[model samples]
Target: MIGSPEHFHQLEKSLARKLGIAAFQSGLQVLRNDRGWRENEISIDYIWMVTIDHSYSGEGGIFAIKYKESKFREKVNPGELVQGIFTNKDEISQIYTETGTTDLRGIFDFNLFEGSQGITLDGVSYTIRISGQNIDTFISLSNPNTDSWKKWEAEIWALGNRMALASGNKEMINLFQ
Candidate 1:
């Protein structure tokens, strides 16, 4: 049920309704960390900051793809893809122009934590942390629970793959496969 057509359809509908967008399938870009690191030190985990662009409006939302463990040194390998909502000031502009606000929690129904880092979707519990420059926010899964990570990753990949398929992006679809 993770990557099923029905699942993808529901996800598209939910995202479009939440983000106030007409369509979720548009342009997809997967960005990898190109920065260098020490030999012994582990570089930043393979985080694919996927940008989903709207075909007609050019507006889109950014989603961060992380892994349960850092396997590949540089390339993105097949593993648990932890999905996160990443939004900075610049990226916020691309997502919301009419609202003119960068507070995602205000726009979306995201439950905020007092001191801890996590989010509750439906009944599942997942960690969430917001960090970056002023007005820049990144909601990532930092929970120690791999099960939760796996489920979240599957949903995200399904959505990502569906978008890629709609846009006819073989490269993006290949990554998920």
Candidate 2:
């Protein structure tokens, strides 16, 4: 559904109230509260970052959530819509370019296709893991001539280390270093 300015505020209020109501009704506690979209801008269709108090235990705890509009509608049609999980991040990397294929090599094993588009997703495996709390990946590709993968792998690994820091996982920081 399209989000318009006039409807955003009401929507936000309704959502917050509902969330609050739901938490109370469900006997959940309120922990951290952050909203990606301001109450005034909820009309625009964009991703949202929300953190709340939750717990795997029946007690309670805190966690984060990132949600995007569902591409699935009344009828499920597979089109050019962005397909991904609700997550908190800058953006998900799309594998549309040969360059991306090359980069995936740093953390994946790719099977090259017999086509000109350089489609490398064919029978490939990506290796992204948290080793000692750091994100390390194993990658292999059918085409070994491209240089993009090696070039970006280190940077990505570094970013992964930073993410570990944000998560308060000290091991990740040391592992990448």
- lDDT tens digits, residues 16-36, model 1? 444433333322223233353
Candidate 1, superposed: residue stretches over 4 Å from native: 1-136, 139-145
Model 1: residue 118 alpha-carbon error in angstroms? 22
Error of 1 at 147 (Å): 1.2
lDDT of 2 by residue, 21-65 (tens): 222111122333365422211111111211111121111111111
Q: Where is the poorest 10-residue window by lDDT in model 2? A: 92-101
lDDT of all the models against the reference?
0.34, 0.26
Q: After superposition, how far is residue 63 of candidate 1 from its true place, in Å?
A: 3.7
For candidate 2, the clash count comes to 8
lDDT of 1 at 79: 31
Q: Candidate 1 overall Cα lDDT vs. reference?
A: 0.34
